[model samples]
Target: MHFVVCLKQVPDTSEVRIDPITNTLMREGVPSIINPYDAHGLEEAIRLKEKVGGKVTIVSMGPPQAKEALKKAMTFGADRAILLSDRAFGGSDSLATAYILSSAIQKIQETDPIDLVFAGKEAIDGDTAQTGPGIAQRLDFPQLTYAIKIQELTETTVTVERKTESGRQIVQAQLPALITVEKELNDLRYASLPNMMKAAAYEPEVWDVKSLSFDTKKMGLKGSPTSVSRIFAPPGRSGGEIMDGTKDPAATVATVVQKLFQQNIIMVNPLAKGGKS
Candidate 1:
């Protein structure tokens, strides 16, 4: 299994700042980490590689600094890593991100055919959960989002359980499928001394638009379709007064319940229809 995991370097949630003028994330100075959900996917890939004996390649699209995330992934025993960095790809939306990542995957496939592509449910920075599906759509591969378990796999097919608001759903797709993983999948393992040493010395292969044989017009900002206009934090609510009910707990509780009843906050209906007649 030549598992390809798509990782993203996202702004640390606590450090996220948006530019009011451009609606762009203030990434220049913000600390970054591998997308949390992608971390789970990487762990799964590593586990699978251990079982089946194949290579796991980590791929990411971001600025030069993102190589740090790739190196972190390499510490977990990924066979190789690639960073797709170019000025033209700056300010890309989900569609453009998926396009760029898809191009990178295609390039990797040329060297060794990719059996599967794993991604996170969403990035904390974007929270769009659109890039994974977008890549699958662009590559014409089957997409299984919110996957919680890999039920089974074969040379030709893969079965998984996807989590939904209603319940868990079982889905089966072909081998070259794309999966957006959930945090429930697996916990990440600590890197051993050898793996850490390997990662410390390994420089991820950097691929620019030219390296991918991509036309500059179709690979960067020119290829992107969406743009952010402005960004700002939402207004906060003012504090409310707290009620005093220490004198008589039951009396105060009854009084509060009565007030809620009068306000129609909670109602008892003798005639409302779902009665077990």
Candidate 2:
């Protein structure tokens, strides 16, 4: 089996800043790290590769500096790493990003024949969570999102436990499926000394727009439909009022009720079906 894990380099949220004029991230001085969710996805892939017998390939699409993220992944025991970078791919929305990444995966599949594709449930910078499903749709693969664990894996099928708002769900999909994983899926392993050395010496294969077959119309800003109008910090919250109920409980209750009525926060006949006379 061959596993392909999509990785991303993102600004550390704690140090992130938005441009006042452009309303875009100011990456000039911000430090970057692997997307936390994607780190877990990569860890799961490497664990599966260790348990069974297979290869793990890490893929990322970003600027040239993204190779640093790929190198970090390689230290975690991935068999190969590929970076898809090009000016033509700049300013791409999730849809165009999926197109570019899916194209690269297809080219990779030519020789390796990938069985499973993995990605984080969502990117921190852009919490949209649409790119993974978009890639699966383009590849015509069954997509399983919010995966928490791999219950089973065989030559022909995979069974996974997914996290949901209500609780959890176990789903089965055929081979050659795509899975978007949450951070709860697995704990990341530290890189071994030998692997660290290898990563330091490693150079990920870089592919530009010309390297892959792409519709020029669907490559960059031209292909993106969504745009950010503004980005600003939320307003600060005001402190709440406190009442002394310990001294006079009944009077305190009455006072609270009277305040609610005075503020129009509660109606006199809120449960009444008809209008108040």
Per-model C-alpha lDDT, please?
A: 0.88, 0.93
* Candidate 2 accuracy as lDDT: 0.93
Displacement of the residue 90 alpha carbon in candidate 2, Å: 0.3
lDDT of 1 by residue, 42-131 (tens): 999999899887899998999998999999889999999999998888877898888889988987788899888999999988789999
Each model's number of backbone clashes? Answer: 0, 0
Best candidate (score: TM-score): 2
lDDT of 1: 0.88
Residue 33 lDDT in candidate 2: 96
TM-score of candidate 2 relative to the true fold: 0.94
